[model samples]
Target: MYRESLKKSLYDKEAVIDVHTHVGMSPRFFRQYGYPYALSVEDLVIRMDMLGIDYAVTFPFVDSAFYVNNTGSSKIETTTEYCNFPFELENRNMLNEVNEIFPEHAHKILPFLMFDPSRETEKQADFMEEISEKYPVFGIKTASTYIQAFVNDVEGKGRPILEFARRKNLPIIFHSSVHPEDPWASATDIVDLAERNPDVRICIAHSARFLEPVLQKADGLKNCFVDFSAFIIHCKLAVQNSPGIAIEDFRFRADYSDPLSVMVKLAQTYPDTMLWGSDTPFNYWIQKYYTGDGKLVEDRLECGYREETEILHALPEALKAKVAYKNNLRFLFGQDI
Candidate 1:
């Protein structure tokens, strides 16, 4: 529906900004799960134009080396040699791709430096600082789970990065999860980080995997924002796994079965804190699995850009404007769109 509407110029192209998107390759995902390894600048820009989006906040993919040790796999030995400092090469490549290849459209592609928490904080900060000086680094992007670190390990891993962001006045967007087993980037930890450092702006990715606590905390924290990338898929998972949780948590009367309506309600309630994101290429590809007989089966869970755009279009005009782009402008630059 959005695809057709966008083609008809029903939406404002200049009013949409995707806050969560990735470029470059992830060797582990490609090898292990048969996911697409590459998303070039041209590829993303074409998709953005088709969906009537004007800008995108992007970073490189989490390197394969970070997952090899945790996944008990030795297939990426060659990749591991270069990926010791995760996202180092990928970030550089992204900077070069946007700045060199697509210089005309560089301003439209807001690039964030990927911060690796497992490495020495000072070293990582030093590299980020050096790169910022060379390129247009808008903000910082990091995933604690990808690096096998906890988001609230402030003293050990998170504090130095927060300090760096504060010093530079850069917003940090984290990859989060609500799954109990993977507590690395839970909403509780993310909220703790936000509470401790009120000066630094922080965005909880994927709406903290659509958890209730994130929405509650974000409503109160001025510096805390939430991006609903992959909202359709994650919200459904949230509702199916825990029925009536949305109604119980937010005290709303909407049916949890319909994630889109719930999303509109959430955005209306927290207009200032909600931001839009598509997660892009990731939302397009489905994970492949192996059967007992060694046959590869594709699980086509297809709630992607089309569905995400539809959700944005479904919102009331005033709320849609904020979630689509205005909120991200404030979150990233402390300004209006």
Candidate 2:
């Protein structure tokens, strides 16, 4: 058996799934959206394969403006940013490329198309509907950075996007965590959406780091999902936000409150409300701690995509199975994986 197959036999019987990730970067948004240093899809996939992640979601890092709206007028504004610092690609192209390269696992590699309403909301929505119909997509990627901060739609920026996906019965993934200085949607925004539209499935990316109280409060939202991506494993931005907390603090509870432990606690408490995700390539923790040699020795056993399956492997088989895949399976597929 291959490494992943063997690992599956040993610990996980169900196919592993990572619901959060960004496979490709736009050269167009490098300056604005990408980190000074970032990983590529080739690098990310190899790492995940080594770590035993069967499949991952490829989220595209797009400029917020373009993601919200893609109209002719918006295109003109977006073109100005393309001189050198901007990099963008069509969703169809990215999906087709991946499908061609990995046909068998292509369906496992879900792509949530990006959109910007200020420019091409209708066009992007149309494209999203087409992609969902043609290819199996978990949902659409919506950034609070553009809709909330730039557009100043504190109330409705993501509403339309979520509504658009709702019609297709797809989910909307939101970047709920706070960046260094950028202000975007908060947990409250997600809460409002969930309360307003119970039918829309929303995944809060990065578990809305440092906002556990807020997220816990929003647990009543039925279609809400949380992607435990890049929160616990030594993310520089997260460290910057909460200074004086060393990475070592996360491995042991006696030292301090580890974010990963907190996330695991949330998962254990509300198993059906969240899914495991690596947030590949762009997010440092997914590639380093989970895949590469880092502080999360336990996470290393997971290969790359940190999930409850790997976390509860040593427990009784029945409970282990529930944590491993059953909970997330219910949320993702509405039944099982």
Candidate 3:
């Protein structure tokens, strides 16, 4: 059924935009976790074509080859002296590569400039402004946790970039987390930021790590959106860790073994604010799961582009249309395509 639906959508030339994806290299992931380091425009386009994705909003890998120590650790070490601008190289490379190498398919690839607020905030914003004029920069992407900054720090470290986005009318996608220790980019902080800057469109990446706080208040803020990239993995982890715990006013039990149930319920509840994203390359890796026999099992999460497409295809026609593409158009372009 999903394949049939996908084929029809493809034949109809219906737009299927993935709102969250990464490109470029991540030495940290490669060195520490043995994940694939390089993801180029060609690589992404091949996967996007295979998945029948019409367009994808992509940005450079947040963890560029700058940091020395693990970012997840208490102490972060960086080769700051040698590389003052964090994502400058990667962003430039992405824009140039798309424009020069993939000129014919450049329209299919929408690149967002990655921002690092902790280092030369004003300079980085200046660079972004310059690039927006030169290239088709769709929006801005920032991970507060990577930079050890606060998303709601409007008057302090976060102000310059926030101000830039507002002035340029650019949407910002933040890498939010549900981890207790990583509160810098929590859904609460992102919501606060969205409330404060009502004009700037803000997307809480990864569905605020699938927490309930953002889902509870998403509809109230017109400029705020959420993407469920890597949601199945997070949901599985949450269920495994806290099977019976309620997700803070979510009005649903987290005890379900199937993560798709939670995803469907949330999407049905907040269809307007939902957007589809794959978090590709990373999603291709193997994942561990506990089987019914209580034995730990290692396998892929079985929720990649094809699986996600199936889930979306299973939705009611109206809701499926919105989550699969319409919401992305509204969020990124301020209109439906």
> What are the models' TM-scores?
0.84, 0.68, 0.84
lDDT of 3 at 52: 74
Q: What C-alpha lDDT, on a 0 to 100 scale, does residue 292 get in candidate 1?
A: 26
**Model 3's lDDT to the true fold?**
0.70
What's the number of clashes in each of the models?
0, 20, 0
State the lDDT of candidate 1 residue by residue for 236-327, as single tens digits: 55556542123345433445578778778778778899899988876755554332233444544457567787777877888888887678
User: Worst lDDT window (10 residues) for model 1?
Assistant: 2-11
lDDT of 3 by residue, 1-337 (tens): 4323432443355677888888888765555544555789898999888877788888988665455554334455667654566677778888988888888767677788887766667777778888787877778988767556566664476578778888877788988766554556677778777888788888988766666666667667888898877766666656555321225455345544665676677778787898888787656545332222334334344455567656655667777678877788678756555
Among these predicted structures, which one has the highest lDDT? 1
Tens-digit per-residue lDDT, 208-269, candidate 2 = 55455545645666777766665444333344434212223332122123444554566666
Residue 137, model 2: lDDT of: 63
Error of 2 at 143 (Å): 2.6
Clashing pairs in 1: none
